[model samples]
Target: MKFYRLTFLASVFLTAVMLLLVYVFDSAKHSFSETNKQFFQTLIISALILSVINYLVVDFLFNFYGKRQIQKISTILPEEIRDEESNLNFKQLSQKFTDLNLKNTTEIDMMKEMEFYRKEYIGNISHEMKTPLFTIQGYVDTLLEGGVENLAIRDKYLERIDKSVERLLNIVKDLDMINQFESGEIILNKSRFDLNEMIREMIDVLDLEAQKKNTKIVLQTTSNLMFVNADQQKISQVLLNLISNAIYYSNRESATVTIKTKVENHKVLVEVEDNGMGIKAEMLPRIFERFYRIESSRNRSDGGSGLGLAIVKHILEAHGESIAVESVYLEGAKFSFSVAKAI
Candidate 1:
């Protein structure tokens, strides 16, 4: 509407100026002859014709260039956002483009983060495998270089080789288990089991190891038999990992690792807490990340695959649950998770 209005006004002004020039020329001539009258009429008709032509040309150019620009912009937009039957709305198009750019930026950032983690994971895996591989190679080379003929040396080298092989196998096994859990390949065989009994069994299993660290494994609960419906084997692994970590990381001379369970709603809340070298506040968030360690030197010395907590997290998540942690830097850390009570 504005374009047409402006074009009409310009054409009218041009016509008025032309009429004024004709009037001035006639006045200067000061004649009212037939020839002068014909000239005046012809000049008036010419002005009107030129004005109409000018208006048409301006309108044609405006529509042509404006539609072309809209079409070019439409091509860059997603099909769903484009309007084919009508001219494009500039405001809507600008907002959509802004949103699309923001979405792309977020996705790019996430990809970069994932790539970083991938590289770090690969490096950690290489370092972990290389250490044991080198140890095994050294032992085997020594045995082949005449050490096999000695009775005691041969036995010792073979034993060390076996241990290295076991460690490698453990790494492979843990990796495979994690992959299975992540890919949804491991199906839970849920069953009714006594939570208290399982805690006792795990404590007994790790009793010897706890004794080495002078740590005591204690179970505290109000109920004797708190039954839960869960994957018994996986739950056992979770308990084992948490309990073992508690004993291993304890800073005290005689550490106390406690396993507690209580009834909450219709669920069983189980907690494994210890008076150990509690993890730093900053380290707690990444504690369940695969191959993440609080103290790398000490963690490696403990001969862990470093996938324990990660596996524990995966198992619990698969059972439609989540685990929580609490800790103070030097006091202790507690890991707790809930399971549905068997009906």
Candidate 2:
């Protein structure tokens, strides 16, 4: 923006200088007699018109430049802006930045904050992984020490240990998957597929688990035998993740998870509803955040790695879809998301 301003000013200044030189030369050669007064008046008018036009053009151009710069900052700066209230000096700096109307500087600081946050995220994920690992290690150690002597008790502890290990592995895998999605390293292999077929297959795969929990898994659609053009594998992953989460979080020993689809406003609405531990009002805004989890009855079913929903959100967005969640505490949670209808 500064460079543009400088170049604009320089060109305007040069043009004004040439115009001034021409006016002075013409005026001097013609002299200031009554016969030449009209010509002098005409020259003055020309100079004033030129100045006004240049001023208006420069003003319009600069305002455009400022707006465009701010827009660019808004796009890339949210990840970088830090709002640390604990540090007085840093807080003051941020406040002064806002008060000073130093927009460009604000954007630069935002980038710095984002880099800091990336480091923070990595540490958080590592710590989460460490907890389950320590638990598994403790269980294994106890079994080796004494529990291994008892066949029946040893089997129980061993199974729990395996569960813990598997949970840890799932967390690690989900993190890797989210990383790939965010980095755009995983390209979806687009293919034609039946939506009902995909949902039915997931139901089949998870049937035993549902039976174990005595849950009823159902799929309903207003449109019969609807087909979609999409990356079958990627879309299936999305359904699997949502369905699995619904099954895990439902409140009752025997629960219902319903997948409903319909055409609304020229788009496909795919909703997964569960009568599970619903999300809190506060966590609703942040449920899709990477590593964010609601600490309540939902965690009882399974501790979330926090990356699953975030991955789902991004994956849908990549395919031009939008996802949202609604919940009534202890009643259940419903995830209503949309994808562009197959054309």
- Residue-level lDDT of model 1, residues 1-343, one tens digit each, is 3365655766687677667767765776654466777667866886787677767767665765565677777767676566443464455556767887898899999999999998998988887788789889998999889999999999999988888888888889999999999899999999999999999999889999999999999999989999999999999999989999999887699799999999999999999999988989999999999888888676352478889999999999999999999999889999999998999
Q: Name the best candidate (by TM-score).
A: 1
lDDT of each: 0.85, 0.77
Model 1 TM-score on a 0 to 1 scale: 0.78
Candidate 2 residue-wise lDDT, 81-143, digit = tens = 433322234344456457656776788899999998899898877767787778788878988
Error of 2 at 301 (Å): 8.6
Best by lDDT: 1
Question: TM-score of every model?
Answer: 0.78, 0.64
Clashes per candidate (backbone, < 3 Å):
0, 4
C-alpha RMSD (angstroms) for model 2: 12.5
Worst 10 residues of 2 by lDDT: 82-91
* Candidate 1 clashing pairs, residues 3+ apart or interchain: none
